[model samples]
Target: MPVSAAALAESLGRVPPSCGPVRLVAVDGHAGSGKSTFADWLARGEVPVVHLDDVATHDELFGWTRRLRATLLEPLARGADAEVPVYDWVARRFGPAVRVPCAPLVLIEGVGAGRAALRPYLARVLWMDVDQETAGAAGRLRDGPELDAFWARWTRAEREHFAADPTRPFAHATVSRRTGGYAITPGPRAVLDPDFSDTA
Candidate 1:
């Protein structure tokens, strides 16, 4: 059976704590895979989320790994509050620093939130189970022709990046989009030949 969004949120609250007192959950997948929307839905209860989009910049999309480790991960791991850098999409630069308190549950959503370097800090990793082709098509349509070249480059980069450091193999949960909502299930790592059914 598909886990309801409410049930998933409750589960997040119950996840065992890792770094300090924080139960860090990472939502990762191809760009335009509805990770942000799903993360928002998952944050309905008391969990606070750290959107990687805010930490990533136009020039340094995937390069924010070091920054994230320095500003967010390291601090949280040490039971200290972190001041994260917020990137301005329109301005194409990083804005003011925003403080993130070490809460019981905190979600980090982005394309590579489940990267090998970050998995150790996360209590659980959720992969938005959408095909790369579909995600790329959606991204191209969403950004339109103006970003055609950028998308082309991004596609290749994303493929290479994930190939070298894939996250699906380590994911704890998988989620697929439905008509009006989403369908959630434990990942292969958490289940044996799990039968999946759609939900909306």
Candidate 2:
């Protein structure tokens, strides 16, 4: 692992586990706020990552909390391995179950990963600090014009989900991906009125 990644993994390892014997960390942000990429970098130490994309389907984008608990949390809570069902976006259904060992640390990366239901199980929550408009634009570009309709539907769902259950306010830290490493600061909850602006 790179120096920064190694340091990050070591830092996370120091935190007390919140879920069973595992430190369940969350990397959450807007759709295109780069949570996946950031989580990938943090996973250079072979940490297991459960991407929400594989857990959410078109009909249940933000309502998979129960499923998540059943598939992952419950098993992990018992100090056992889990088989997380991966949703197939192309087929609009669950494709296969991915085995996840009960590792010492695990990361949940996606929009709404730090929602209320999962907060209690998380050792730390890192919000990807990026504005909605900018992130949405990046999302649109990445998915391409063909998925414009999907993006439109998604933005609405995301907006509603955040309005009802905001995550940033409860985050332990806010991470911004910089040119080479990353800029991590105290989150909204850690610092009053934290200036998490991308320009900052």
TM-score of each: 0.89, 0.93
How does candidate 1 fare on TM-score? 0.89
What lDDT tens digits, residue by residue, belong to model 1 across residues 1-200?
55466666666667788667888989999988989888888787456789998987778768888999999989998889999989888888778998888888888999899999887788888899998999989889998999999888888889998999999988887888776677776775663123333323
What would the per-residue lDDT of candidate 2 be over residues 1-200, giving only the tens digit for each residue? 11377667778877888889999999999999999999999898499999999999899989999999999998998899999999989988888799988999899999999999999999989998898999999999998999999999999999999999999999988887777777777776652122332325
lDDT of 2 at 147: 99
Question: Where does candidate 2 clash, by residue pair?
Answer: none
- How many backbone overlaps does candidate 2 show? 0
In candidate 1, position 111 carries an lDDT of 87
Top candidate on lDDT is 2
Deviation (Å) of 115 in candidate 2: 0.3
RMSD of each: 2.9, 3.6
Q: Candidate 1: where is the Cα deviation over 4 Å?
A: 191-200
